[model samples]
Target: MVSKILIFMLWFLVWLLLSWPPRISSFITGALVSAFVSFMTMDILVKDRPSGRSPLRYLWFVYYIIIFLWECLKANIDVAWRVLHPKLPIRPATIKIRTDLKSDIGLTFLANSITLTPGTTTIDVDKQNGYIYIHVLFLKEGCPDHDMRLPVVSKFERILKKVFE
Candidate 1:
């Protein structure tokens, strides 16, 4: 019951933020939609609610958002530089990397983080083996043993493991 309310509030907040300067009609419509969606999906959305009941996890999620935004900014700059330079430095390759995160939420977060980063996209995920195939725009040459755990994935995964797992 508490989880349902939280989900509804979160959905309403997102709708309000996205629809800034919310009018009375929009507010009522958003509230109704958010309530219906939250009530319907509360079970799946909050399946692991007990594990994430701690307030500390919410704080960590906020911190993760901050760090993720910074990383995204850096990635954008890097990609822009590569695009503007005369000599394109992008060495695109699809590499398979493994993750230790066990939960579906954790894996989804990690995959989304990878895709959100400017230079990388998650191609596919092998859930059974915990392997994610990612296509990267820039790959340094001769670094055959280069760490596949990109900063974005590693850092976000660490925080998400704490938050979800």
Candidate 2:
């Protein structure tokens, strides 16, 4: 099927990129692995194959990567500071936030992005309501009353809407 071929190409490209300077042996091995893996996982790995993404979506994806890296750096610094400070200024709490993205792929990317950050972990996703519960190592001083959506989450959700939704 077309999807299986696409998956094989994707997997082979990743193999070549990661195992750079692909020698004959590695190239042959990657082809075999890619073919086997793609065939085996085609049905379950991606339930919905989005059809014909706009060029703008690719641009948004690139922007999302930049934003994600910047947010990740900030989170790393904040976590490191908390660890080194004598007071360990941390008020860990779980808060619910809303996302606009509706597609399963979009939600998955958003949740994974949150979990990948240093200080936050996505606890649960309410798919029907577009709500995510996230555990944060440090909540804002008045977080219980204030908007619970962190800027990183908002940025990711926004860009992901353009990219995936």
Q: What residue pairs are clashing in model 2?
A: none
**Deviating ranges (above 4 Å) for candidate 1:** 14-33, 48-53, 141-148
Task: List model 2 lDDT by residue over 1-165, tens digit each.
Answer: 666788899999999998999899989999999989998888787566578778799888989898888888888888899999999888888889877888888898999899878689999999888789999998776654455567768878888988886
Candidate 2 stretches greater than 4 Å from native: 1-3, 17-21, 50-52, 142-148
> Each candidate: what lDDT?
0.83, 0.85
Pairs with backbone N, CA or C atoms under 3 Å apart (clashes), candidate 1: none
TM-score of each: 0.80, 0.83
TM-score between model 2 and native: 0.83
In angstroms, give how far residue 18 of model 1 lies from its true place.
6.6
Model 1 Cα lDDT, one tens digit per residue, 1-165? 676788899999999998899899889999999989898887778874444357688899999989888888888899999999999988899988778888887888888888878688999999998888999898666532455565557778899987887
